[model samples]
Target: MTVYAVVNTKGGVGKTTIAVHLATMLARAGQALLIDGDPQGSAASWAAWRRDGEFSPSPTTTVLLGKAVFNEGKALSQGFDNVVVDAGGRDNGGLRSALLLAQRAVIPVGASNLDAAAMTDLLTVVELAKDYNPDLDVRVLLNRVDPRTKDTAEMLEWLAEQNLAVMDARVCERVAFRRAIGEGATVQEINKKDQAAVSEIEALFKEITQ
Candidate 1:
């Protein structure tokens, strides 16, 4: 199984959204298990909504566990093709365990000055994870990017100068994504013809799996 964790020390950075979509995308292709380690229980809440028939793909499987639940997650991913984990923010033990278990880690950054500044903290977490696994392949995914804004360009250039590995595709701020959670459907499931969303996810998947 390919284990990938969608992590960011900063909250409200679209971590859960990305996790949900990525898991569903892989699920459409094959089987996937989603582990929600956030104290907020956002993913777990979404799963409840789905099971209640308040969203699409009702009854989709999801595990909502606290920090230090890595052993359970590890066991769950054994026969799965993909295990997408939504690790909690801050120095949670689950986050550390997830990093240690993940073959690849993706840090999704929102296009904002504060979010950009938060990258430093995220990098610190990455360094911590490196101590446990030097071969960890960590990359950044620019999310909620405003293409027409100067911040996008400046941030990209700054990341480039810092020698950070960034995914080629950027997840733009879109209404479809904003509404996806309540509907229990990812952008692709809502509109398979959503070329932008599909391409963005596909690119990130390719970058990590490669």
Candidate 2:
């Protein structure tokens, strides 16, 4: 099984959103597990909402909470097809533990100067993790991007110059994303009016998994 950790050192960068959506997408194929390493428990709450029938086409995924699960990553992987961990938004023990076990560390950065600057420390953590897991793939995902905005274009150019690997697919700022998540629904389960949002997420998933 493959393990992915959705992480960001800064809060409100959409880490939980990415984690839940990615796991839900993978679950379409087979069993997938979501580990909420964040003390906030946002991902766990999303799963609970799913269980309560807040959304249709409910995710066939299981979610586990706490940092202890990070120690058992290998054992958990043995039972699931894919394991996605939603690491907390900070430089903490939970994030570090998830990074050590993840095959891929997916970091989401918003299209803003503050978001770009915040990545420095997180990148350092990723570099540190390389000492133990040299093969770990570190990917930067551009999130909450507005393509029409000049800042977004500049951020894209800046990201290209960075040494880090950035995904070609970006997630545009959309009301559909907020609405879906607020209602505890995945983009795939949203209405036809939000088809573009669904497509954007699917593209990201394909690019990352491929």
Candidate 3:
């Protein structure tokens, strides 16, 4: 199975959002498993919201939560086509453990100076993890961006200068994301008013998986 981890050292960077949505997107193709490695349990909570019928049930997706998730996640991934781990937003054991098991790691960064500054520490951890997981594909994903703002352009330029690889696909600031998550809905499951948000997610999925 292909394992992907949505991780960042700083909180509120949209790691869980990316993990949950990416897992749901992958489930469209085949079976997908979401592992909640964060102690906050955001990903697990999202799954529970779905189970409680706040939104349509994601039948193709399975979610498992555990503190010692890396080894268990590897074993559990054998039954699924894809596994997405939502690691905590800290330079902790959980992030390291998730990196060990992931084939690809998506580090989400917002379009702000603080966010750009935080990337240094996160990238350092990723660089160290690469020694063990030599095949790990590390990529930076711009999140909560606003195309109309100059910050977005500056952030993209900053990322381009970094040594880390950055994905061409970016997630713009949109109410659809907040609305969907608040109501336990994926972008695809949301109403027609959020079609643009859905399209952005679909494009991101295609870019990542391709």
Give the 10-residue window scoring lowest on summed lDDT in candidate 2: 56-65
Best by lDDT: 3
Model 3 regions lying over 4 Å from their true place? 54-67
The per-residue C-alpha lDDT of model 1 at residue 51 equals 64
Model 3 agreement with the true structure over 45-124: per-residue lDDT tens digits: 78887877655435234444443567777778888889898888643777888899999999988999999898887888
Number of colliding residue pairs in each model: 0, 0, 0
Model 2 lDDT per residue over 1-210, tens place: 788999988999899899989988888777788888777778878888777755643434444444565666657677888888888875387788888889998998898988888878888888898998999999988899877888877777887787878888888888888777765778777665588788889998998888
> What's the CA RMSD for each of the models?
2.5, 2.0, 2.1
Task: Please tell me which model should have the higher lDDT, number 2 or number 3.
Answer: 3
Question: What's the CA error at residue 163 for candidate 1, in Å?
Answer: 2.5
Of candidates 3 and 2, the better by TM-score:
3
Candidate 3 to truth, TM: 0.92
The list of candidate 1 runs beyond 4 A from truth reads 53-60, 64-67, 191-195
The lDDT of model 3 is 0.81
The numbered model that scores best in TM-score is 3
Models ranked on TM-score: 3, 2, 1
